[model samples]
Target: MLYVKIHQLSERKFKITQIAKELKISRPTVYKYLGMTYEEVKQLLEDPHRKARKLDPYRDWIIAWLEEYPHLSAAQIRDWLLERYPDMEVGESTVRSYVRELREIYQIEKKNIVRQYEAVPEQPMGKQLQVDWGETKQKTINKKEVKLYFIAFVLAHSRLKYMEWQNRPFTTRDAIRCHENAFQYYGGRTEEIVYDQDHLITVSENAGQLLLTTEFQSYVNERKFKIHLCRKADPESKGMIENVVKYIKGNFADSRVFSNIDDWNKRALQWLERTGNYHVHQTTKKRPAEVFLVEKQHLKPVSSLLSFESNHEQSITRNVGKDNTVRFKSNRYSVPLGTYNSATDNQVYIKIKTGKRQTLEIRKQLEGEIIAEHLISLEKGKLIQNRNHTRDRSKGIEEYKEHLISRFKDQEQGRTYLNEICLKYARYRRDQLAIIHRVIQEDPGWIDEALTKCLKEKLYSANDFRDMVQYFKNLKVAPVRNKMNDSKGPKHAKGMIVTTRSLDAYTSILGGAAQ
Candidate 1:
């Protein structure tokens, strides 16, 4: 009790002299107890004559939890104790000390997940660079949480790193810009670059044949750098940049409050200079900044920046859907009808223009002809279609109308009805004639009755004629179901069954409940 009290008092900002005076002990005794580790104090308490500790009853359960989980903290065990035994009284400090003693005595060391890696031979200076991406959740000035993303680049030989931050996820164009920025920062480019199979750079890796995104491919061709794309799920291929990503997240961005992306990046550059590059690397034992001085001489000279105006738009390949549409940013834009021919390849290229009001130009991948264009939609899941791309309705409408009129019993009356439809619904003549043709296909006899009813009732539209034919057809089928339910009570309807209860039965049930 005195030991715990001394420690507790010390924790409350009590000085050694104040602790000794309050505990009625000498300063030397306080110093000796404070110096003793939790294990040592536990040994003292383990003497045969020592009084039992408050947590002695729950010792076995704590051991079991620690052994099973191996990662349970002292505070978590205390929380579990309070949850299970609400009547129990124990301080957090006392539980912490007890948990520590139990762990040491049982040889139950907490373990961390460690990745297996083989030593990779270092590449020659200016030979290669590794790339990776990371994201972190940070707090804004209002204390609201916001997610920030960043791309990291590291020179393979010197381990010199550069990173750029964005408030939004990066596109292929943004990645190209970041690549240029990294080259400018390093004063040149390496002969080859290593990267994970990121979608911004690569579209697919079919049987090891890498298909690069159009924008990234163009950028690579312009810079003339070789690419080494890492296989899927293989972090060992680019572990150096992976380690840099972790180091930046843990050492720099973990506790930093984000104001904006630009400020975050500016501060990140300062961090790289003072600590990241200045610190001796664990493997090489040489500062990256110092090693980079020699590597910079070996790097290829950087060319002038490419004109953004010429390559301002990014082209992405998309498979045209059966509806002759391509999906971009959650919305589908129409191409010309028949663009989706399943017999041939249905691929098209979409060139996205990035500006105040963005637009997209779609072209046939093989022919490179401009097949369609539309202003990009801000709304999600929308189908933006151009009316001109729809099949022309005026091509064979007059002949098709005559064919539908030929199916009617009286061609003269059919002509009168069809002409009236054309006169009334000039815009929807094709649709009305199509519906009438469909009705003739469904039941030839019913169309005669429907036509007679329409001419008598002045129902000129095809929809009314279709509905009247459907009513006559349902009348023809009603007797069959009526015969099936003939033995049932009168309460049963044509399409539904209803059970009718008498009022006397309900009154009897209520009377029994009252009793």
Candidate 2:
């Protein structure tokens, strides 16, 4: 090819060294075909007079094996021949030499030679982000070896990267949370997010259409971002993120004394800000954070994005307000007072089933012992209290008020608080009474203080009373149903029933006594 290119120079007698220098080819090769035209060179190359080989007789059989197992090395084939037929022995050199010819004949060299692929076409700003996960084993954290699973997000155009590390495998919820965190880190999100055949998000692919896991679909639908799956078995499609994963392992995680997951993530974030984003990216030759400022404008801000939990299917545990309501669809949906009014267990878990239909039903999960359901609301943030749901609490309300007023009705401020709760809670007045009853059970000392604060703030729920108790206990404000305190966290349960055992039964067993 070099000789051909040099010979094509019109009217220029290019020196052999000049041809060699221009084409980066050896001088001897340039001189070998210096005066030859392209046609003469082609003819010379086509003149196939090859030397005979000792293993030529077995060449056909060797080619068959090569066809069956393309990965078989020359030495393996030579050993197989000697072992299979003791009568016929072939030297290693002869076998290797014959294999070279076979490779040329069968074009098998393409398999062994490292291929150079064209770089992916550059996407427009904010067009695409590639995501992938990497595993790091034998990582020592806090004096123990652990396996680390980390995900990487790379902005195709800017080469900006977001790396999040976890000590455990990512569930669907974890992946969604990481994506949200990544978008927040970058100040926005790309138009399309690219992914490998990740099992958490992908179900399968048919021809070219990508089939995503239902949870992931809801996640993307909520954010209004497009999802692009890399072609099956095509690592090159998401090569950028693959490179980023390697980069993170080598640069950030390797040779470092790993701490716990949270500490590792915190340090990783600092490392990104200090070095990864600020320093020059090798390919782009631009600081990612600096270029990100320009690219950020084109990306969609998270504030404008309304996604899954807001618009799509959501299952969460919410404390019912004091008005016989458990908030859902950003509206006050009615629950029976027995559920929200329980003195010992006022918490209820909600699961929204069969989404995207008119007249969706919020059926009670029987295992949860839920006793109420509501029609799905299209409008958001409205008070959708059912009048009849509160009516059942009316008789219970008057009875509880008479009992409470007889007890604290003497205290002037206490009387005012009870009166205000009765007016604000109405049919749910007994629900507020349950809160007072729980305060009396858990900490009678704090009941007056908690109720005084609750009444002043117009907070009329058991959770509010607990929040006040926690606040007074710790002298620091915390959530009412914080996961640390509650047996279950914010995530609602599905297909699982929660059962409790009394301490008194365990005490009886410990004392070796019959109940």
Candidate 3:
């Protein structure tokens, strides 16, 4: 009561005993009021008016600047304010505090204002799993280069993580492979996989909704797994996996030197088992591995569909020859002798199949029937000539002669004469010689007859042999009686014709002609 009377007086000059006696209260109560001085009373009265010390003198300007550029950091704002007002000294902590206050106020009044995201409640056990790609610096297999990119996954409740090295560019194949590997590593599959909308898995902008890629969706459907895609750019939606990535980068990958990507992934898995799974979680205070053991019972058993199946479609095309064979990748693949002449109006379609190795199989489909098949090689400038149809004659005369002799052993004399003609033509054009050599190999008996006819006609050029062959096919012989009459008499008698009237006369004439 004395303390109350002292507070009512607004003066601190009263003695503790005098106040206690006057108010008839306990001495301790009087002592409580007498402890405060006059200045303390004045300070208490003016508490509302004591302007809160400006944590940042230029806070208003900084807030306005931040409104224009939300990405600007506290240090950046401090530097900018110092530039504008040389006398205004602002620390990064003060700027951060002002921005934080602005954020809190904006969040309270404006529902649409961007704020720090909080993760949604996760279901217990195998209801959901989070997946994400994490990157860490690592040495390559040859120890000559450093690379990055590691795909990581985490169970929502248990926080048990699965990770693997993905050193190459991200693709649909890589995404599917990572999912299959992660499920196997976890020993079971969750009911659903929760993922941030990555282009590799989603393939298209979801218009602010969830949409999975066709290939990825097919993969999930085959295993009877549900697909859950998070909002775009919201990494916290799959916070468990994101946190695992950060933790692994800091605890394992930062200081470790791995000889290869496999080695790095092996070390990461070991660390997850030893450091991450065995360690107690900060909030739950339970070992992740122990929690996972309970969660494992809820997970679905592994499906029979193993990973790494071929997802490629097949196509086919026919290659038209530059001369008489189809050429692909600098290699000549032969078709039948006149196949191209009949296929002038058709278009050839090529087929491609996808797997660990890219296999390109070329086929010619005519009237829905495959006519030819050839394999393509990747070596530059290497010719792949079809040995079943043609021979390479680029080696010169001795090689050509040996080839001709081997093909025409039944007519050695004729083959020798043809070799002489090929040599004579080789003096003018080497390619012409190869053509002549091929002609001789095709029919050796035609060589001696062609050469003797050429000699009788004084043929010297390669064209002369062609002309002589044409003439020999068209040559006509006159009857012997008409020839003798023309030799004995005049040219006028050549107009008369003789005909056999009886079968015996005609038979005698046929026998003489045959002899």
Candidate 4:
């Protein structure tokens, strides 16, 4: 073929350089091939005995595997070789070259089996809506890649789409909030909503019963919408929204340099107006925005938005660092000292107030009480701390120590042990005092014993003191607890039900022994 192309190009009066450029080959090679006849070229190039390749010994195996699994790639073949023969030494490039040669020589063409999808009949307006999630990595203003997750909602009938993006993964609360936004954007809600069995909403599916997350279940009940959770590995059931997700990623998100999330969302809305909902859909052949006008009338009126534990307050959980700070949007905000408990998890709830200038209210996990609040910062890597939160909560350590010592029988010994703990763990004095104070509250009887043992053994830590207290408490004999009296129990139950004249009967039976 090379000899034919070279001679044919020469007969057509084409220059050697032009032939080499057209064929993407070097000029010297073109000239060398042009010098040989077809028969001579075949003899030299198709020589039976060529140099053996590193992968030549496995050529038959590669050919067999390729013939069996036509879609197998060269990298997969290299992995299989390494897996099968641990001692084999081969490079990726060598395997790729060998695989290509084998495929070409043996005519083993790779086949890609595209999944067959049959179009389902479109539902009536507001009858159904499909929901799906998508994610993409895009460049920021600084050219750094940032991953953005998004949820897409599309009307099954009109294909009108709505989507929201965030820098973090969607939690159940986030998903519920997004649903409210979608309902407001569409001006109404659908009778039933379809989902992809995502954990953000559905917790589990058992025997055809779908169990949704607590928050999501409440949202669904409030919205009064039926949920249709698609089976696992079956995205085709909700293909409408799946395609919408793809459309958003490819057209709206692709190549768009993201700045702040607010700006990105603003741009996304603009794109939806000009392109996404405005442009003609390939399958429907009509603009989604136009179809939405007619479908909007049939949609059920959207009820008031859900209160996610607070009115318009978006809540998310974050881990408090050892330094008593929680990170949000690359900036750290201070919580009060003692917020981070290593024994338990350090997760705290961050409630974002909805307004023009957002304020973050960091709350304790269990009580949901606001521990700290700060105006949200737009800048990155900043510490937006409150001066009050940074106050040394351990400033009252002297008074707290004295109060705890007063509870001990030997106040001087208590003071000495606490002072030693402070000297040894200056940074952890507050934690030590807290543990000792809790131990004192539980049982001050063991304090003298534990303090004496700790002082004698030179165990200066609060943990050792607590452990010693526990040991001493366990050694003390437990008080005898009397059984409950039925007369003092609930009024509904019978109390002992003893017959009358019991004393008289006993006296008569023991008449001889009465004395």
C-alpha RMSD by candidate, in order? 26.3, 24.6, 25.6, 17.7
Best-to-worst TM-score order = 1, 4, 3, 2
What does the lDDT read for residue 299 in candidate 3? 87
| Residue lDDT tens for model 4, 175-258 | 877888888999999999999977677657877798775556767777889989888887778778877887787556755578
List pairs with backbone clashes in candidate 2. 222-307
Residue 403's lDDT in candidate 3: 60
Tens digits of lDDT, candidate 3, 50-116 = 6675654565776676565564555445545554565665555777666655543332121222535
Query: Which TM-score value belongs to model 2?
Result: 0.39
Q: Which model scores highest in lDDT?
A: 1
TM-score of each: 0.50, 0.39, 0.40, 0.45
lDDT for residue 157 in candidate 3, whole number 0-100: 83
Q: Worst 10-residue stretch by lDDT in candidate 1?
A: 477-486
Worst 10-residue stretch by lDDT in candidate 4?
Answer: 490-499
Per-residue lDDT tens digits for candidate 2, residues 1-515, read 34446566423776667766655455665566665777887786566675556786777888887876676667557645654565675665777777865764454532443534347787899999999988886447456778889989889888888888887778666788889888888888889999887777875676877766556677877788988888877877887887788667755665456767788888787667755676577778898888877888999888745445553345444555666677666787776543453333234456665646533233333233445656677889887655645543545665766665554423676667777767777775765676565455555545556666877788766567666875676664321322355667553333335677887888887986545
Name the runs in model 2 displaced over 4 angstroms.
1-117, 141-143, 304-307, 310-515
Q: Clashes in model 3: which pairs?
A: 315-350, 315-351, 315-352, 316-349, 316-350, 316-351, 317-349, 317-350, 331-384
Runs in model 3 with CA error above 4 Å?
Answer: 1-119, 139-144, 205-211, 307-515
Q: Which of the two candidates, 1 or 3, achieves a greater TM-score against the reference?
A: 1
Best by TM-score: 1
Residue 389 error, candidate 1, Å = 9.4
Local lDDT at 181 for model 2: 86
